[model samples]
Target: MSDEVKVSDAEALRFHAEGRPGKLAIAPTKPLDTARDLSLAYSPGVAAPCLEIFRDPNLVFDYTSRGNLVAIVSNGTAVLGLGNLGALGAKPVMEGK
Candidate 1:
């Protein structure tokens, strides 16, 4: 068998459109299955961690995914091929899809 197969431009576009643009998927770090899990992730159960973070400030990393996250901040200027989108137009391609 060959190590690689080829795809047409149209097929690639279809895959990109159907899946995430950057192929980046964001799933929950914690489970949300039962009613208890739901409450803990959102409401009363979450309050405790919020309080702890408010008290310590640094606990946000431990309780949330912030520690392992990277925000893609851009001015929308200098997008490849379509240059100088100026924030508004640049948002759609910000993920480098």
Candidate 2:
């Protein structure tokens, strides 16, 4: 068995360009349909957690998206099978275009 994978440029382009136009999306983890949900997500309700986090930084995981976030550090010098696209040139690739 060969350990190589192949994808046509047109296929890759079509896959990324379809639907939302990106490989990632952000959405509210909690219910935000009601006014109460909105309030709890911001302003008066958010202030309480903010104060708590200020007092103890460890609470960040419980109060925010820090725990679910992942960092992908890349300068865009090299892209998958595309050689060097440079930073600006690679922006589209990074953005899933």
Best by lDDT: 2
Tell me the lDDT of model 2 at 17. 85
Q: Tens digits of per-residue lDDT for model 1 on 1-97?
A: 9978899979867876885564577888788999999999999899999999999999998899888877787888888778888986676566554
Residue-level lDDT tens digits of model 2 in 1-97: 9988999989988987899976788988999998999899996689999999999999999999999877665677678878887787677766653
Candidate 2: list runs displaced more than 4 Å.
80-84, 92-97
Pick out the ten consecutive residues of candidate 1 with the lowest summed lDDT.
88-97
Where does candidate 1 stray beyond 4 Å? Answer: 1-15, 18-22, 86-93
Relative to the true structure, how large is the alpha-carbon lDDT of every model? Answer: 0.81, 0.83
Return the TM-score for each candidate structure.
Answer: 0.66, 0.77
* Candidate 2 to native Cα RMSD, angstroms: 2.8
lDDT of 2 at 57: 100
